[model samples]
Target: MKNADNSRRAFVRFLAGSPLFLAAGIDGKSLHRLITGSTRDQGEAFDLIDQVSQDRQISSPGEALDIFDFEPVAKAKIPPAHWGYLITGTDDDGTIKANRDGYAKWSLRPRRLVDWSHLDTSATLLGHKYDTPIVICPLGSQKAFHSEGELAVARAAKAKNHLQVLSTVATTSIEDVIAARGAPVWWQLYHTSDWNQTRAMIKRAEAAGAPAVVFTVDLIGGSNRETMFREAMNDTRTCTNCHSGGQPRPGVSGRVDDRDNRRKPAFANPAPGAPIPEAGPPTWDYVKRIRDTTSMKVFVKGILTPEDAELAIQHGASGIFVSNHGGRADNSLRATVECLPDIVKQARGRLVIELDGGVRRGTDIFKALALGANAVGIGRPYIWGLGSFGQEGVEAVMMILRKELEIVMKQCGTTSVRGISPAYLASR
Candidate 1:
């Protein structure tokens, strides 16, 4: 009998070598329908992929996996600067590399023949049950990619019965996004120089029935995203949400002096001479103000330290997301996963510990759960799907991951997410 890790490696290798998956004969629509339909039954992961491939007149799941080769497609479709902004890492990308490399340091210890037929991937976070243990990480400026923008993303999330975290710098208004999803969504907030504006945004979220408020704390200063600047030099397209205030001018430091000296200005076509609101720096008092203003659950994002995690709990944070801002923030920070064990230990279950960074496979989801994350957030991949096929593309991304997770659970001799624990992993 093949071990679980070997099977996964073989599957990945098969995907690498297979040509049939890329052939034009396979209709993406038909393949999508078949895979989604199989989710209802106690379907085996590979079985569904195989069925989809065959129905679509393809050779195998390996061929289908080729669709994820994002670099070439993304490069061709997006402008060079935009591509750089989308793909580049902060400060030489060392931490970005480590974010995924860290995962390799931990190996799975799979058990066999435990009668693991019924696998459940459903998870509940902050008192809400999600179809999958994945939440949509808040990524701003969707209009930069597609005209439908955030609305399209929201529609996709709603279609999959998944949760979405709307960014404070979203192109669409909070009310509009909530309306599009027709349900409560999570809102991601950043502290601004104006307390009134921050308070108002929280009130708006509450009024719109937002389930949680995720305060992003890592971006006290804007990241050194040179790609976006390069792109702006040629393109007129600006991040509507971020540009609504006004474009900042070049400061003495030669960097764009954004109204909020905290964030770096990356968008184009800023309203001329408009006062750039300062973000200054944030304090724990801001957190308390946020907590006092909203009845919704408060989650602090960008936490990678156990001490910060503990401090968040003390400041009335109901949850903490261990993220490196998708490697867009500090370049020297540790990978979010590397800090999870310690943060979880310090949190002591006082707050929900969610993680998001370099999660591209079903095993990645499994790894996070085993190590101690309440749930994981799916970021760039879903957006890549959106960029490729709109709502259908998003659906495909989720389906692929959910199916992979099911297979991982069964092979690891587990029937439910609850069955996952640190015991399932060994230090590499």
Candidate 2:
């Protein structure tokens, strides 16, 4: 099986680099996807489960796997609707497109003649040291994408010693993920209509040994994802695997609960007998509420502004997850990377700033750090890896970033993750 998969990858690579692919009018970038754009997934979608390929656990051939490799393979493997759900951003893909351009917004100043040997990418977040600043952001409904869902991702995180933030809507239970990986995982929370449930979740994370809580606050309403909706309507993959194996079918009434819950403000209406007459999205008071309820460090995940970052710090937050909810919440004009510098400037080292959205490469991670991000969060890349090769695929994705970051660090004379400063950046 290992030989076969490697052969397939090799064949695809050769085909794409061949004159035939280019003669077909495929650009150099699209050639790889065009060549690998066939059903290579060993698993089939059904009511029962996503079958694990015999090669699911096999390590890559030590050759780096990038999106060009992962994306096409995943596209061929996973169901179209699931793929669309994982990749699509809000209305017209404005934010997603903008995110890709964010890295180009700044230029790195490479310094030569420095002792660039033996680089370090390790970073410390909230007193926890990580092998890399690349964190796995909380993505929900893993079973929706693959049978392993959060479990596979956790396995990869464990192997890499990278930090992973689990979603509340994750198909794999929080306890199960921690049990599978035996690694300290952070939890991402959303205020449901039931504040009791919300509080219970926080308490659970603490009980489960979560060191921190990333309470996402950006998604107060839904945005347009016409692509996902269209794909769901057209997807041929059968049901029975939906809702982490509970729902009888996929796309019930075309409802995407994970996304729907995001846009709706948490605790939008007041609980009975509450002091507040009416309700809106949970405010800093809500931040205080969660902080008081748990012993764990608190971080706000959806911050895009200095004001919000300030409120999070003042409200006892240990850090800020500077994001645009991966541009899934609304068609915000600015990408999260574009928004990072201002937020970092405003934060003034008062908060541990992390960012997500458009972080597909190692250079992107380096830029975020150079512009004041303490860490970087990834959402789609890992999922693309997850669908392509299960746990090993995800591991390869991280390895790719780590390897690329090493190249950047070595080139830019940034010897340590801590050494990455604004001095390395020249705003474009």
Write candidate 1's Cα lDDT for 358-390 as tens digits.
888888888999999989987777766666566
RMSD of each: 10.9, 9.0
lDDT of 2: 0.75
lDDT of 2 by residue, 43-92 (tens): 11110012122213223525444654566567667777777778767665
Question: lDDT of all predictions, in order shown?
Answer: 0.71, 0.75
Q: Give the TM-score of candidate 2.
A: 0.79
Query: TM-score per candidate, in order?
Result: 0.76, 0.79
Candidate 1 residue pairs that clash: 21-63, 221-262, 222-263, 222-264, 259-276, 260-278, 260-279
Top model number, lDDT: 2
